[model samples]
Target chain A: MRPSSAERASSGSFELFAWLFMRISGVILLGMAVFHLFYMHFVFGVERMNFNTIGARWQNPLWRVFDFFLLAFALFHGFNGLRVVLDDYLSQRPGWRVLAKTLVFVLVVGLMSIGGYVIFTFPAAANLAAVP
Target chain B: MKAHFKIKRFNPEKDREPHWEEYELEVEPTERVLDALQTIKWEQDGTLTLRRSCAHGICGSDAMVINGKNRLACKTLIKDLGSHITVEPLRGLPVIKDLIIDFTDFFAKYRSIKPYFINDEPPPDVERRQSPRQRARFDDTTKCILCGICTTACPVFWADSRYLGPAAIVQAHRFLFDSRDQGAEERLPVLSAHGGVWKCRTVFNCTDACPQGIDVTGAIAEVKKLLLFRKL
Candidate 1:
């Protein structure tokens, strides 16, 4: 007899999520990258970009929000891209695939955790004097 | 050299449980694993079942898991393997019997990507000339022999069979990057969709297992970059 839908659902569908994440993240990265290029290169002249300028920019809540968005999207897009590559090339054995992907997940999580912490707690104005 | 082979055996009609059968054979150092298998089948066990053709690595028909790695039996030398060998069917595929795995699902995903050129223009009376550099762009992708080594070596396929796997994506890449092929627009969405190229995790196993030495991960990465940065 065929299994019910619930049984299949309960089996877990993480691949579906990963596939969806790639498309969504790819779209978001597109916007974020363009905006980043525009603001950093076009709006703020290259010559004016010193430590002080960056410090002053971060002092504003809006800039902090913008930087955070860039950081999150870029990291996720890179991690997802790496995941796809791993799936394509890694050994097919269940044990080996699980072990390798687990390692990748742990490393990505670790990097993201450190980056998120730094972004959230970054001192906005303390480095103003050092910026020049 | 004399070596022992421990082969996994299963018969749905005769046996309810799988078992291992050992065969000892005298073989030359340079003789391939397929040679030893042939020796056993001809001289010792006629009922021993397996699949092989061409006796070379080109056909991709002899792929199996040997010493915990996916490889073509026709290409692996017994001397390089060691005193004993463990041979089994490729993983992530349905087992039809002792060594043959059903390839229906594997080929189905292969065909889903529309593995052919799709140009709207009619064929010219004369052959279409391509620049040497343009032809170089697709040179590596054209080497794929439809070998399941990369697909069976992939972790994504093991976890999710629905994934198009590395081989199919690499095949899709063959056409996607070809200058003569104008279906990149239509192929990109399908290749980047669910169970498509995006599902691959770049572990480099496909690159390692590919008997043709094709850069499988590199092809997948190029596809991802195209989908991400290129419009449509």
Candidate 2:
């Protein structure tokens, strides 16, 4: 007896999920990126931003949440976009694709980790005051 | 000047076999390949079929394989090639007729990337401010004429039609690098999916066949760097 169609289709959901993820992530980034620009560039003028300004913002739990969202969304968005381009052009050689996506995942994960850590353990304003 | 041209012909409705038809033409050395083709169609054989419009390279209407490489017939000069030339429709695309390939799949892939600036907020009444240097960053990628040369030359797309290909990637790169474009965050993950930028093998054939000399591999590399590093 031949194997059922459902069995074959179920095995390929990983690829289907990847495609669906692109559409979903692409939509989410559309909104998050807009909000990000509004907060960073328009809400407070670019000239007014500095280390202290960022430090102050990071001190707030709400802003920390904002930063985390930004980091995650931006990294995923950028990575997924590159993934599409790579798949389109590099599908012939499995070895090359594996090596390239591995590097990409590593770099995105590293940046996300650093950004997340900075947001999480931000130095308190009192610490800055005590230094002087 | 006398020139010899060999063209691949296959008429599915009439002929069961694919064959090459030869024609001789008298033309100036500086004349383009399109000119010779025109001579053959008008003087020697009316049955010959091909697609063309702008006659200039801009429309990307006359892309074909010339002398074993993909190129725009309108832009290639007889002086640059030997007296003998072979012309055929671009490889890797479904041939709809003589020298015309089905572009529906190609355009669909291009559209999948959402190749437009997506700023949900209303635009400012005044011009959006961007420094000249910011504009310069993406200027090279903006020159793509949607010519299928890069996509057809790509081995990845050759095997899998679902892959978005280089021309679309270059288009994505244009918006990805643009300062005014607010969709980078959304565009990236979509581009990074299964048939996305992850598939590029970097053979550099697209770079060689590009008439505008855009660094396609370099742009793909830049996209990879941005995706990996999460920043420029």
Candidate 3:
């Protein structure tokens, strides 16, 4: 549908920042993913998989923080991409658009919170339990 | 075939508001929308107003919103659109009369892109030579005929007049990618603004609406990539 001339000037920096963030975050995510892929497949290989390997990797806080950043950025990036898709298809349907927006928001928040807590706190929890 | 052409008519001098007037006409299935419009004006109503230079698709003066899509009136067949046809001026422009919208705002954005060549260096005695690959880079965007269909179909342009609509961006892409052009740096800052190429969400409406089959979305993406990488 067409918008009248007077309604055309919706100016704000928020959408501009979002657009910039998408390009920057996309580049960062690409680097992070390629690094992870090389480390897992070529450097260590899949045959090294075991609970002990996981326990050894989490001993360092840096790796834990790296995984946390990866999880958070990837989840938000994916859902924001979905937001564009939802708007393109469901913008005309107000009710359905609201439902879709709510669902994506909940999923992003839930995944980030759960991933953050486990990634950042599991190492501390293990140390506390080891005291006994 | 018998068909009802529902045209949105408005004249500032005569009508207080735009109205849809249906003209019943007998047109062949293969007859173009332009032909149907001609029937209405020639036989039924002499005062019907529209702009069309070439009856074929080359001129691009008869772009209108037909059955919810922006298309070249000379190109769309009546049979393909079925009997019931709705013709309105292109969206996001001031309608002056029946099927003719003002292009002043559109051309302003185009002029802002500096559509002409802006290289400061001296040219050779012959053509400033460009390899086939260099020409191929911007070939798709050069086909734009200033139809305004792609611009009107763009939702971003509809929401923000400040946004340099798809047509303008495609025009910029043409020069930015040309090997002989040295004005990319000058044009880059202009397009780097908030309402620049960043506004494109790649919803594909502009590409779908282009009558010349130009890959409008792809050109936009190329411009974005050029901005991100600073290669152009």
iRMSD, all candidates:
8.4, 10.3, 7.1
TM-scores (chain A) of the candidates: 0.75, 0.80, 0.83
How much is B63 displaced in model 2, in angstroms?
0.5
lDDT of each: 0.79, 0.81, 0.83
lDDT by residue for model 1 (B123-195), tens: 8998777899989997898999886989999877887775778888888889988888888876665565656
**Candidate 1: which stretches are off by over 4 Å?**
A1-132
Q: What stretches of model 3 exceed 4 Å from their correct place?
A: A1-20, A23-132, B14-16
Q: How would you encode candidate 2's per-residue C-alpha lDDT over B59-140 as one tens digit per residue?
A: 9989999999999999999999989999998988878777888888788878777799887778899988899999999999
TM-score of candidate 2 versus the correct structure, residues matched by position: 0.64
> With candidate 3 superimposed using the best TM-score fit, by how many Å does residue B145's alpha carbon deviate from the native?
0.7
Model 2: runs farther than 4 Å from truth? Answer: A1-132
C-alpha DockQ of every model: 0.07, 0.05, 0.08
In model 3, the Cα lDDT at residue B35 comes to: 92
Candidate 3 falls in which docking quality class? incorrect
- Native interface contacts retained, candidate 3: 0.04
Worst 10-residue lDDT window, candidate 2 chain A:
A1-10
Instruction: Summing lDDT over every window of 10 consecutive residues in candidate 2 chain B, give the lowest-scoring window.
Output: B189-198
Scanning candidate 1 chain B in windows of ten residues, the lowest lDDT window is B186-195
TM-score of each: 0.68, 0.64, 0.70
Candidate 1 C-alpha lDDT tens digits along A1-132: 112345334533344455557778888878888988888899998889986777777788787777777787777778777766665555346577667778877887888788778667767687656533
